[model samples]
Target: MVLLDGLADEGSETVVKPVRFRIGREGVAESVGVDVGWFTARGYGELEPDGLLRLSPVEALYLTKYGRVAVEDDSGHVMGFEELFSRLAEKTANLWRDYVIYMDLRNRRYVVKEGFSPHLRFRVFERGTYPESAAKYLIIPVYEGDDVVVEELLEYVRACRAMNKTAVVAVVDRRNEIVYYTVSLVNLINP
Candidate 1:
């Protein structure tokens, strides 16, 4: 259980109380201190006239001093939080795939093939059954567009670097029915 104090009011000493709570089966508990100016910062819950901290339950769940969960879009959509995240992830993956394809085409090392489910796969140079090495694996999906993808890509790069593998990321820009691709080395061989 962890409790974070709201911003302190003018001339008032900020006091943070501790509490315990569980988020998606993970137990988290800690205490945090808040100064008058820092506690009153925007995006945080505010105190009420009655001296009780006023906070939206949803907002509380989404933002706090410890960690924050993403807030759903303001659109009055009917989909649940999990469903929205899933849809976002799918779209991001498609973008990444498109970017990879564009890069392959530009590099002339890969061609359009019709046998795969995604309708694309990188053709690595050198034959002999493609050695069981990390170099042989190209075009790993890192993310779709959400923060999850960013975190996953970071973790993937870290893991790959730990194993002495190079991590590459391809970016695609789509505008006015045109797709452009850019390839960049994500990081060196160091986790």
Candidate 2:
């Protein structure tokens, strides 16, 4: 894993000076003067044209969870993880489910980005081939016990095929563990 500047090991323990980010009035977190080279080069967040690193809710949550960034409230008080969690969680449909899958993928070293549509939760690039290569898989998040519609699954598979990518459904169970299934369409001609 690529360690951010302060997350590196210092002698016996890892010293982390979390980069500070202020939650905008719009609820999006923005950090200025951060190590743009470190973040943008690693695909953590978008480096806006105005030069701010604007983190998505999940990105902010992920960084905060690992103590890589500190999120502050409007009054300038730094929020604890739970506070940040509750705030950020309200912004997305299923925060815990998405974060679990995102963290799992990141731990596997895959470059992941938010997918184009709501049903397609994330676009995962091949390990070490981000920015240079197109995404290899479109991940659709499925919570365990949630009804799975066959037509929806077929649509996801067709969409992946149209983009020359594979459709991977990440099932997040009650335990928060994930299992991935590759969905595809196959035709068997009569002999």
Each prediction's TM-score versus the true structure: 0.26, 0.90
Q: What are the clashing pairs of model 2?
A: none
Give the number of the best model, judged by TM-score.
2
Model 1 alpha-carbon drift over 4 Å, by segment: 1-107, 110-150, 175-191
* 23-75: candidate 1 lDDT, tens digit per residue: 21111111122232233333233454543333332223322322332223335
Residues 33-82 of candidate 2 have per-residue lDDT tens digits of 66656666667877778888888778888888878789898898998778
Q: TM-score of the candidate numbered 2?
A: 0.90
Q: Which candidate is the best by lDDT?
A: 2
